[model samples]
Target chain A: MSNDNIIYPSVHSFSNLSLSDSSRTGFGYNPYKGPSSNAITPETSNILINKKTVSLTPTSFDSIYDRNILKKVPEISLSSFSFLFCEIVNWTRNNSKGIQDLEQRLNTLGYQIGQRFLELVKTRERIKYSKREIKILEILQFIHGAFWKSIFGKTANELEKSQDIENEYMIIDDIPLVSKFISVPKDYGNLSCSAFTAGIIEGALDSACFPATVTAHSVPKEGLPLRTVFLIKFDESLYTRENLRFN
Target chain B: MTLHSFYIFDRHCRCVYSREYTQGSDGGSTNRSNESDTAKLMFGMLYSLKNIASKLGDKEARNNLKSLSTGKFRLHLFETATGLRFVIVSDPAIDNLQSVLWELYSNYYVRNVAQNALSPVDFACDELLANPKFVSETDRFLSSLPVFR
Candidate 1:
């Protein structure tokens, strides 16, 4: 069982061929395309970019950013994240035309993060061999439990399906981390910073192939003034598919 | 103890990585399309097996199937939270296959492949296979396992 038996060619060989071609022509060559001419073998792994030599290596990128290298779950300071998030909200607020527009912008921003996170979280959970959540209820439980824990270090307080409507559901959180420091002025009128979180949920669900509309509502309780309820409204087609597949 | 092959499948049931060892056959004659067809069949079988296990298990228990054995070989499965499936086919006598799967996921797949920007999330990453460091490290890890001896 020697390594030689593995038939794949080295990526470095291709990289070397491109480097030689570029050096000989004294012009940048597209590495993706095959080498145009035989050229000098550069002494270093550096590549010329925009007329400046830039150091490059297979591992030049951050290894920590790699999901696998940091074996234990990574952590970021709450204070750091909070400050950064505050700046994002403030920036979004400054540019927004109105409250609705502000919320929409925040949602759009959160959506992309959510899409990437869905894959990241899913990749982390691959160890359990859990099947993809096909049922509406099952997927919600996943979001409320594993997904929530991954992001906030805690499970959601409650998950309730709306009794009046078949496709409506609610996930209640006592104090959403994103809005812990935010207080909406009276004029702001029902604005919840949790809207960002709602966008994240919406993005994750949308990418997972469960299209739904998610919105955050501020519903403060006696002691928990920052309480939030995320209302999820699934598309009618989701219900139709659920009925066809499960029933 | 003996290990035969390893496979990684993404959420979309696509084979993102596959490697065979100790099989003695070069498999050089097999084309890309044939390999893809084989992957599809394997994924379909695994999908059905998972669903069947879920339906047959007690409702309160975790539904994921861990491992199964036959007269010839055994199949070990480790599923990530995102629905990526890692399957290892090995000798029936092998022990602690789950740990091996964990090492492969955390050490090799996550570090060298997932973090690489050149490697796309949606397709099999041949660049990862071609990386000398990755291949060497994986070889070292697998060789250290008692089963490989």
Candidate 2:
């Protein structure tokens, strides 16, 4: 029953508090002194692809066979977060360049929250297992299980290591709550801020000093169509370590 | 007159500028529930501030407040459309006040400076007051600030 080796932090205890309580405490670190004078900027960073900034290719697969994975779990309503997210989307749309720009804006916003949440959650776990996640698989597994469960109250659908790719993995979530009530407008095209959630995963992973590239892809599994697969592509340095260990 | 007064008691941390200002009816108990909740959060902060200021002593505490601003210090509290705003100033620069006011309004607290030019929240004498709750709260907060001690 105990998966103590996992690197992600536990957020199950916050379950007792109401959503209102969570809202009051949302990303607001109220210290007696005051809010931090430092403001975090998310736009400065680049999304590295092939060790260089490049446009994401939706058709690219981490692994072909892994796409068939199935997950069995009942859906849950996270109404409070849904409302909060709607406002976040509304805010991002305020000065957005277009649909893609808006999605990027939302992704940037979520990135900081993700980085902060990981630090806070990791501190809660026991010291022996609480060390920062270093490897690609360990970090992906942490995101698929603990991070998803903490944020959405359920673990993700599946975590698969790509067979052909040197350092790639897929995290599938059957229902991303933000996408539940949302159908992107035609003008917006294929843009999705669930990609923001992927950015969060990347931010947390990178901040913990585990460098990786992450992007969100819409892959609806049978019977449940809102499935989102977060593809995490780790850098070559990661593979070098794995190879060294095996050799 | 030296105007030195100190009173020690526990449970809540509050000091009245004039003892007569301390009166509040325990009547119509429904309102008491709302007041009590606000008091619970505010009192802890006030108590901690008292504990901090007491350790600094009157001279050091007054100097600390004075250092924040160059002009005369005034304890100002404003009742906004929602919640309250508290500011302590010995001197006011238009720029400082503007930035603070901007932050206040943006934070959704509409500042209402009443005709009397006084705040709803009580502020005590800058002159030496030995009151234990006040001293304790002040001491508690000031000790934490490296700038003070």
State the lDDT of candidate 2 residue by residue for A1-247, as single tens digits. Answer: 2332222221322212222342221232221112331122342122111123232355556655455323344455565566566666766777788877876777677677788777755654446356767556677778887777767778998998789976778888888866764545445567676877887887787666556767888877679877888888876765775677665
Regions more than 4 Å wrong, model 2: A1-77, B1-149
TM-score of 2: 0.42
Candidate 1 collision pairs: A122-B82, A125-B80, A125-B81, A126-B79, A126-B80, A126-B81, A127-B79, A127-B80, A129-B79
For each candidate, the DockQ is 0.01, 0.01
Candidate 1: list runs displaced more than 4 Å. Answer: A1-70, B1-149
Docking class of 2: incorrect
**Global Cα RMSD, each model:** 29.6, 24.7
Q: How close to the true structure is residue A230 of candidate 1, measured as C-alpha lDDT? A: 94
